[model samples]
Target: RYDVDAIHMDDYFYPYPIAGTPFPDDRSFSRYAASQGFSSTQRGDWRRNNVNLLIQQIKYTIAAEKPWVRFGVSPFGIYRNKRSTPDGSGSETNGLQNYDDLYADIKLWVEKGWVDYNLPQLYWEIGHKAADYTTLLHWWNANNFEQPLYIGQDLKRSVDKNELDVKIRQSREMSFVQGNCYWYGYLMLDNYREVYDHLRSQTHRAKALIPAYTHMHKGRPAKVKKLADVFTEDMHFLTWEHPKQPRNPETAQRFVVYRFRKGERVDISRAENIVKITPDNFFVLPYESGKSSYTYVVTALDAFHNESKPATIKVKL
Candidate 1:
């Protein structure tokens, strides 16, 4: 009982919906079945097995990978149904749930100490008929995890002038839900200005990071060697090179460099960046320093936040 140290996890994978056939559970198991975990036709049971390995792997693997790190998942909220069973994790009207359809028994994971937290995707308006905030919220709070619980909200959904008002009020009304994760960071800028007010408000802002496993591996990165522009004063010029990435062995390889001036954070407020960053090989940084300086640094960022080592070039103004 006292052997383990921390929880570890991954996001919900394999999105729902089967094309023409139903969710391939029995079929998957029959065609590629190993020793059975449970004997049943309930597609939900097999689906649970699909995620069960993930949940178990998340726990043990985290212990193996980084024992001190905690793991959690933010599955689509509704857990299960009371009408179907005596004890389910949904409200009277809560629709098909993660446990039933998506086969994520997140609560079981929390209760069994398999996970450290559950960030339920509670992204609904306060009084919405199908999935009211008040009821589902209480359900989550009432069903406490041995770890912790957090809400993942759709802040962009609050961008509506009318809905934004209610969301602001609702934020003020809850306490036990702990903190929140705006569905995505861009939501902060996309939301109605008043919605920002609610987030910045004293009451809601007081609840900062919820206490949990805070340690994880963020690897040290390599440094920039040099930086210089290949393009001259000519406007539509382009230039690029690489360090770690292997270039063409049989032919001269081409590279595209997205240039920006020093000290320019990516501007998310607008549809694009403020200093006019471009993807066509090189970008013209319009600031005084950029116009004068020839040295510049370049880094890579994947569609996700996986950042790459910086490559640099040296030149004269």
Candidate 2:
């Protein structure tokens, strides 16, 4: 079986409502209502219950098989508007609500601890008339209900001067925002407006480990052993014996390699020095001949990516 890290579902729950039209699920609903202990009169409620059952069952199956595999959803940005659910509506946006319109009770799932994380699609700009990005960001952040919360960003808008910058800045400023999930990865890769370069140079200069979920798998992996530096084909490669234990919960799933300049102190905690997160025990050091000597450190990572104590070697260029 493949060992996947996480399973994510986006805003594909119930369809966004269309004017003067209703989704046709009556035949299936009527067929299973009595057997499922619900009534035909409760059609709307039945539909919502069906979606809930599906989400919960998926989570249960994944957890039973691999407790470390996370399950998350990216629902529509607005849960409800002030007019519809005055008590529970978290924002001023009048856009479609996942709760009322789509019958996907995202808040209940988060409140009941059914999801590992929730990434709502807050795709509008800062001052849009219907759904302001800033407004929905705070709304989602406040309503996370202890579950990890990440925002779904519109990557196409990232080229606009103040748009991506403000979104990233605000995310960094907010304590509840775990991170962001960019929409349309290909556009960023195509370097639309040089967004990729901008991100690499400024916002994301270093790699970060996915945040830990301590409740599930809470231990570090064994350290790398017998690390050695070898030069081959004009490339400096570091190969090491894999951690003694390699498959269980506490065993190494991959390795994190960090490289520091000769005079600088080696720090595994900082992401700037990190060269790679790889499954192989060997890593090619980013060394230029005639340049300063570099110190390299390698650490093992468990299924949950908890890093082990480092094993280090200093090499001359």
Which candidate wins on lDDT?
A: 2
lDDT of 2 by residue, 90-159 (tens): 5787888887889999998888767888899888888999998888888887888756889999888655
lDDT by residue for model 1 (1-317), tens: 34333442434554565657675445677754345654545445766777777788767866675454566778776676567566543565557677766677877787877776777877777677878766676777777553467777776665552454454455445554545667667656764555667667732543221242322223322332334445456542324533433221211112223333345543232222222233234555433434553434444322112234556554333
The models' CA-based lDDT, in order, is 0.53, 0.82
Give lDDT: candidate 2, residue 144: 84
Best by TM-score: 2
TM-score of each: 0.55, 0.86
TM-score of 2: 0.86
Task: Give candidate 1 misplaced runs (Cα > 4 Å).
Answer: 1-14, 18-20, 25-27, 31-34, 40-43, 87-89, 159-176, 190-194, 201-317
- Give candidate 2's total backbone clashes: 0
